[model samples]
Target: MEAHRIFFERPFDYKYAREYSGTLMTPTLWITAAYVILVFGTKAYMKDRKPFDLRRPLQLWNLGLALYSGAAFLIATKEILSTWFNKGLTATYTDINSFYEGTCGAWAYLFMISKYYELGDTAFLVLRKRPLLLMHWLHHLTTLNLVLAGYHYDTHLYSWLLWMNTFIHTLMYSYYLLASCGYRLPAGFAKKITTMQIIQFCIGLSILAHIGVLKLFTDREVHCNWRMWWGTVFMEILYLTLFSHFYYVSYIKDGGKKFVRDQNEKKQVKAQ
Candidate 1:
């Protein structure tokens, strides 16, 4: 096997990462429960109150998250590609050491911790009286627990999820940041972001299916745990369904006439 330069210079202690994440499992659930309660409570509290103009805070929050996701995406991509170049694609999957013992492991641990920070996104939405959808809050709550569980299980499959998620979030948060600064992309751009999300879910499902086939039909040794694999599949499938419905409702069903009209209005206001 050829050696590749490791981007994560610090020694990765997979054992400690896994054990620490495992310890957080119980606490994370408790926190998520409280988060759900708080989200709804705040939403109700703000129902009659005038929406606060939180433009500056929202911009700063989005800017911070966008930068964080962008940096994480680049590091993860570099780490994974280095392994793929040196060891071949299969090594990244079957070789536990590649994911858990390398620099990516360190980042993966940090990625898991970052989910907690991400919950603040909902805080901004609620405070601003933005129309909070079920998908928005549910996603935040579920992802926090899912990442915690994924790390605790030490599933090699997390490489795919973490890489794709950070990439999506980089784009997603960057878009939000720009919008917060009073810059709106041309019409249909928002839909494109959702489209990318749908594609991501589809690709994730395909990868899981491919791995399942390899594990079941072939003699290849795969390291994915059944619970993690099934859990991911279920979650991705649910997200696909929800997001597809969202696309249909927001764009397709009504021909996106209202959506486009709203965008044009915003643009016109900016023009004036």
Candidate 2:
């Protein structure tokens, strides 16, 4: 029990002790800027060039990410469950006013840092000359910002976000791994993945919306930062809209129609 508690504890006590708090947002901003440059620069360089055959590297990357996300999900679930069972900890953890006091704040910090690594997914896309849809990069950029801010602000809501996102990515990267390896699961498998992502956005939005209702309409004090809450709402709404568009374009508009058109073309070729 003692070993488990220590292992689950946040691993950054030195940063807290040294009070190098400015280190958080400073690097986050710099990295975000550099990421933008690198992405577009790569895109320009790849213009009119053959796409890299990154099938093997991509498969390895996806497999690694799937495992990493799975580990994060399990660790976070354990931390939450452990904290919830202790009476004193549970009260503070569940209290609206004391959200910043989660025992898992260190893990939240780790989650924020992991977002930087997640940028590699975009790097792979750019290298392969794959489409960088608005939904893809925007989601990455906005999520990095949100997680960075959430940690600095000690927004307790991010605990749930961390868990949900890690869980979704577990499934998502697994699908990516299989797809990259030239394996197709079923007819509607891809659509089902997008639908799951859309549902994730819905659940995230509802949590923030529930807080809004309590603060504005009800008599609750709702101790979280309203600014952060509004920021979350904006991010969630954008994600929901962009992902819905991607789904429409993929499964409904392009996917099904393209299949029919391909079949027609094949039939005409046969007749000729």
Per-model C-alpha lDDT, please? 0.79, 0.70
Local lDDT at 21 for model 2: 33
Q: How many backbone clashes are present in model 1?
A: 0
Q: How close is candidate 2 to the true structure, as a TM-score?
A: 0.78
Number of the top TM-score candidate? 1
Q: Which portions of model 2 show Cα errors greater than 4 Å? A: 1-22, 81-106, 216-223, 258-272
Model 2 Cα lDDT, one tens digit per residue, 1-272 = 13233235565352352133335567777888898899999999999898787889999999988997898788777766655665333222224222233444454555776798898999888987766877888788778987777665646667667878888889889988987776745656667778888898898787787777767777744445888888988998998899888777656785567535544553554355
Worst lDDT 10-window in candidate 2: 90-99
Candidate 2: lDDT of 196? Answer: 80
Candidate number of the best lDDT: 1
Q: What is the lDDT, from 0 to 100, of the residue 225 in candidate 2? A: 81
Q: Give the runs in model 1 whose Cα sits over 4 Å from its true position.
A: 1-10, 94-96, 261-272
